[model samples]
Target: MIDFKEKVSETLSLRTGAEVTIEWRINIKGVMTGWCRLREAALILPAAEAVAGLEGRLSMITAYLSDSAKQKGVREIAFHFDLDGTTLTLGIELPLEGARIPSLTPLFRNADWHEREFMELYDIQVIGHPAPRRLFLDRSIDPAAFERLIPYSTFSNGANSKALWEKVMARSGNNRKELQ
Candidate 1:
């Protein structure tokens, strides 16, 4: 497990040429939960390492595909790496704006539906995917309308939890006392 994490960290650092954060959480069953995040693009290495490391432990990997907003025209892809004991799930969030889907079918055979789902839901262009078709979205809906439906936000959690909770309770319908 340690070797796997190290490999991923090294590869991501080398490929993206950015600082990558590596996190590992061991569940009760002693299964390792690993994740790496890069500021820019660091998809291939991280994906490859996760697959390689969790080969025996992985059961399935599910990709949740989406894209950036239409206005920006900048592609932002995010991947959720899940290593289920039986199946490893890799949830890939494609950019809604200027979306480009990299072909993972060649590397991971299970990524076909994932790519399809992205194409269907967010109208992302999945290049080189063997079968690039709609997975969940209705064929009736126009592609332009579908793009608007996708949520666009930059997510970050570097705030004080206690303070944030107090503010939340104050605004909530139920007026509960804040815990000090």
Candidate 2:
């Protein structure tokens, strides 16, 4: 069997300009696990016993990231995959001004809700999604106010919401800090 983890690392390092890292982790069951990262892209390879076909393997990683977003309260997700088993999953904790959601619909049909939820909650625009219409937000509410409420309500009250909003707006220039 191919050592997919090593192949993935070598492939990404050769193809992309970004520096990449690889790590092996164990789940509660103590099984061998592997994942790789290039900049914001994350690639997860299943345990040897659980490995499957190419499409199935990629689907598993995307599903894992989706569940992770739900657990982490991430409002947006930008994910894509290339030929060499390199997958990118961008978890947006909160939306920032001018944030553009990457289009995964072209790559995976299942990415529809993941992108829609990101748009509805974080107000991040998903470029080239087939159905870009609003998903969860009430159409009646103003778009600006809708964006305000999604992240704001996580705080205790209006004051805390305003403070958080100001912080988000202020850090728009830097991608590293905007999600914080």
Candidate 3:
């Protein structure tokens, strides 16, 4: 099997109309893994298109806010794809507030679940999602409760309460009265 290194770069460059950079490493077991940090968040759609053109499969999507990223006022999302058994991860950076990214569900049907999970976990806006709604969370819980409401150490502590909602609303810059 051929490595997707060059093909992926060429395809992404063509689709994004920019020099797409990708780093690849092969494990001792001969499985290849690739990484590409998109220059801008808006470029993700084009990059996804490029990967789809290469017959890649969307394997996973991960959104994170590291302490450094929070300090820098940004969050990050990584899209992992399987290109003929090789792994390629594309990283995108977005603003901490009002972060929005176009939906990849149109290209990868599996993206719907992960996109919804992002909304439930981080308050990310998945624009143009075919169907957008709460997956498992209730309307009372903060959209970004994992980050804003509960401490990471006690994420599953079942701390959902009226007072917690008020605190989250205040921290989110929304009036606590809104929860009334």
Candidate 4:
């Protein structure tokens, strides 16, 4: 069977008439990881254009909120669309300082929950969201918890979080400043 990554990439590029960037990820053991950057900021226009042009079922939407992102003043939102057997991931960058992105729930019914999650967790504003409510951790939940991540070492008894971090840094090699 042909690779779904290539087919999905080609289809989206052709459909959108934009240069869609595709990155196929593979793990150390040569196992295919079902994660790819199907498109970049170049594809991001109006939310309506994306909803109408891309013919697919929205599988999931992942929002990344980080301290560095807060420093940089932008959040990264990824939309995963499943077209038949293939999956296409579209990356959308949102300003964290005062994020107010158009709601995708109007176009994709499933986006309602995901959008609400980000709004509550990351304090983002999803404009025109149908029913923006708290999915988990009500008003009483500490807002500070969302700002910074608690190191796993806090919970571990003898785990050397520093050593683990050093290993991760060694693996990554390049000291690229990731938004976190």
Q: What are the Cα lDDT values of the candidates?
A: 0.51, 0.45, 0.86, 0.61
Model 1 TM-score, all chains together: 0.52
Q: List the residue pairs that clash in candidate 4.
A: none
TM-score of each: 0.52, 0.49, 0.81, 0.57
Residues 1-180 of candidate 3 have per-residue lDDT tens digits of 343567788899999998988888889999989999998988999999999999999999999999999899999999999988989999999999999999999899999999998888996899999988877666656687667756533454335766566667777879856645
CA deviation > 4 Å runs, candidate 2: 31-37, 40-95, 142-147, 150-180
Candidate of highest lDDT: 3
Q: Backbone clashes per model, in order? A: 15, 0, 0, 0
Quick one: ranking by lDDT, best first?
3, 4, 1, 2
Candidates 1 and 2 compared by TM-score, better number: 1
- Write one digit per residue (lDDT tens) for candidate 1, span 1-180: 777667656655665455656676778887876554444332644555545554532233333333333345444445544444422223333454465656667666666776676565454666788877556554644453344543221111213555455556777744555433
Better of 2 and 4 by TM-score: 4
lDDT of 3: 0.86
Q: Is candidate 1 or candidate 4 better by TM-score?
A: 4
Worst 10 residues of 4 by lDDT: 38-47
lDDT, candidate 4, residue 34? 38
- Best by TM-score, which number? 3
Judge candidate 3 at residue 112 and give its lDDT: 94
Model 4, total clashes = 0
* True-vs-predicted CA distance for residue 40, candidate 2, Å: 5.9
